[model samples]
Target chain A: MSARNHEQWTSPPKLAEGEWVDSRIYSDQTIFEEENEKIFKHAWIPVCHESELKDAYDFRTMTIANEPVIVVRGKDMQVRAFLNVCPHRGNMIERRPSGSFKEGTPSGTPKRMTCMFHAWQFDMKGKCVYISRQEEGYQDRLCTADVGLRELKCEVYFGGFVWVCLDDDIGMTVEDWAAGALDCLAPSLNEEPLEVFHYHKAIIPCNFKLWHDTNCEFYHDFLHYHNRITGFNDAYFARKNSGFKNGHINVGSFEVQYDNYEGFHSREELSFPHLPPNHWYMIDMFPGVNFNLRGSALRCDLMTPLGPDKVMIEFRGLGLASDTPAERQTRIDHHNSIWGPFGRNLHEDLLAVTAQGSCMHPSAEKRNILQGRHENETIHDENGMRHYYHEWGRWLNRSPSNPDEEFDEALIAAASAKPAEVQANA
Target chain B: MAEKHASTIEQIKDVIYKSCLYQDDLEWNSWLDMCSDDYHYAIRAFSPEIRADMEYMGGGLEYMKSLTQMLPKHNTDNSPLKRHCTVYKVEVADDGKSASATSSFVVYQTMLDGINSHVDAGESRLFLVGRYNDKFEISNEGVKFSDREVRLDTRRLDKGSHWPI
Candidate 1:
């Protein structure tokens, strides 16, 4: 082994305008804080689906940015999200990830959410129902009618996701937030009665946006040797990356050659009725949620920032509710084979993002996110990521290409004037 | 009860040991032979967070066939896997035609690359801790493994092993 030779320190080369970005946007405390407040707080996030909260009184606890959120289904069967922080002493009410509110329910059909701290209780509807010794403390000054859990804006979609926004005035509902992007996917997503069959979460050591970039950037297909062997034919190149207003994107489905891979079996049966056989489609909503659908399976990916250098990503795989035991097994088989926790392609993506985080630690170096391809606006290009950064600029009030300056007014005017058509994804 | 098992227990235990040995030796083809035509193998674990049992890997016999074929392409660690199993108990079916057995297994992976791969050669790293739930079919022809589901006690698989553990 030659121990005498030493490699020279090389810096990330600066590229021309609109070609690269300063990596400081990833680890800079100020930028991360701005993203947590200006983006994560205001953005409409699809936290969980209706299927996960199928039963009455079912609840799921999660943290958005740093805020603990409790998404619960009331006895009336309405899905709602609360701050999860008790109003009395600011203690967490529901401490578990997914559980039922078994308190105050004689029949067990429905119950009130009770807090162990001070015994302050709230109903599933998030209304303050009881407080221990309420009259003794305030003497009717503060009673159940006067106090309740801090509620957030929530809207459900035909796709079965419960979308919540921390912003008081969420400008638009989930339907409008997705604009027409969800509409484009409605053909396949709504036709089937999809239920979440698999849920797994992993903490990738990287920024939330960094992890999200992997979803929108299709050029990384080269990194997956398996995908490179099976996913880069003519059909793959023909994919159209369709962009919508408010940072939503839907990469049109293309027929895949699962059998083309040397070692894997082909997906031959039980494709969603609306989709072409052995085809896949992807939908990435602005800041938080991502979904991909293929034969007999649908996966919803959601991410919440733990820190500037840490991201918690969750993947929920969905299959039709009407699926037989055998059909469900096949669906799990197909989903786990490709998108499960130990999936071939997905693990590679995770490893790549973490590697990027490692090399660009503390965001000392600048990296160019080359968005150069213009070849018929297909999957081989960077149109999706370009559109995503453009939306990022709009939300963060800074150009991704040149973060110091604001995006040109003319570009904003052009986007707002031009109605979002399929071609607009470019 | 141990005496009641007699030769049957020894025979079943021997089959279990051989299966573990074949897998640890990375003799994929030989391990396949030890299984029946309808062989079913699954890697399962329980997740307390979701309050449900989880399957990390597994499928039908056809899925197994495809998985076996796909082994060479997986980007697993450049290391070797060795398993140590202790046959805990065996309960033969009432008809004396089949038996279900459980065994505690610990799979250790040896790192043969990276900084410590060469210097610490043969030093096994803890890979997986689990139990094997096996179903055996005893017949005049031979004792073939009909099913083997490994239920793991751990969840966080850092980078994870591409090959079955």
Candidate 2:
């Protein structure tokens, strides 16, 4: 209750080797609320794969932080996103999750998006094309020109994945944010259009951050009982720290080199059908999304907070665009086997995260983030948490206690300092 | 061509029961023997809500063989599962070479603690009731499945077991 106590809560612990994380971050309501606004609202979020809407008029509707948003391919086949709610009455304009409508279709027929609530209609460009009560309600006051749906800044990444940003001041573009992580994920596509083999959405009884934090750590592998069966690599994946100018962090995992660890037969003996023996990487976004490219197939998980203790997680499977029907099926099967909501590995993570939530009650305040890696491997020890919290602190307008909080300044300096590198890349 | 090779209604029902029994009894080798080298098995779940696309969770026969071998290490702390399958309807192909069978199943997962248990039971909601839309290739070599699609109705899977349902 004291000002000092409040100050302590705001300031993250100093970055040091073998430092432990306080488990309170997962359970605290204040921290959760702050993150929802600062991270989820401000950071760029992955809406859908571009392959889902390849042709013009292809559209998909999704909600970000409960704000209805529509992703569509416009007249020029350019992908764009807009607020899914109608500007006139706040009713959802798009009914289905995904579909295609003709470029210039009349409202209420088929392709036209007609709001069931008021019969207000919008064109593919989200312009108010038709209004049933146009002159009845108000004569000249109704400005059809100003009634276009609110649009969001959307951009497609290398692998047909689209990320949308609600924050106008987003400092980093998709390219800068991805860095070299994209280089690793790009090959997973195998030059195939990303396809959703099996899509799963689970609303679990736990805070969203708790679930997000569960995947962020590597220490929990021992907690998974299945690790005993499938056999785990003792070769810890080296975690490197990189961030986009907009504050997304690239926590890339080095290639895992496994020895003959006798757990689930042998890794060599029962390996995945067509995956590389020693390749793995994951890129976690600032708020709550992790794009993991495992072997030849890619897995994208987006964790969104519905409430203080309720989280909705979506797991998407992506395969090669040019894969044979059978080959694509095989890729999907392998992808789901290891990573689906029902898959052995993912099930354990769900259980573990739920258990963490159970233990991190409000009464239990003191917590530790077991980042206690050895000195050399701990180079980016608190940097992951620091990088996230640094952005969190900046967005929330609260100064972090860490004296070395120079990520923002460092970003600007790097931009101006490396004129040659920037120009060359540009 | 696939419809021409489907087994009879009765034969299809028996095959579905035998496949479950083969898994329940831990006759892993026998299960492998059921399918020919060109055989394929897919566990798929399709969303009536999301277009006509289907998502395959597990596929191929060799992978199933590997999965059966790997199940022991990953058995949950909960009690081992005992599956009870009941066939409700079987529609045989006119040629009697292949058929589609729909079965209602109640899987009882007993816990090791002996204090608590869980049961996943469902009927032919037309979606979840896993049906063996089996295409048969019957020559002198006896009956073998040319293609088998296990369509499940339950959209969300809590724990995916390696054992075939």
Looking at model 1, the pairs that clash are A243-A425
| Displacement of the residue A23 alpha carbon in candidate 2, Å | 3.6
Provide the overall lDDT of each model, using Cα atoms, as 2-decimal numbers.
0.75, 0.60
Number of clashes recorded per candidate: 1, 20
After superposing candidate 2 on the true structure, give the runs of residues whose Cα lies further than 4 Å from its correct spot. A1-18, A103-107, A176-193, A223-278, A341-344, A361-366, A378-390, A393-426, B1-39, B47-52, B60-62, B75-88, B92-98, B104-132, B135-147, B158-163
Fraction of the true interface contacts (Cα pairs closer than 8 Å across chains) found in each model: 0.16, 0.21
Please state the error at residue A340 of candidate 2 in Å: 3.4
lDDT tens string, model 1, B9-107? 789999989877888777777778878888888887765445556676786566666666775665444567889999999988766678889999998
Model 2 agreement with the true structure over B1-165: per-residue lDDT tens digits = 434444444565676678777766788878777776677776667753334466544555676676667656553433355556777766555655544555666565543421222222321112134555565655566666666776776665533444565
Per-residue lDDT of A169-283 in model 1, one digit per residue for the tens? 8778777787888875687778766777777777766777777777876888887767777788787888887778988788887777778765466675878767778888888
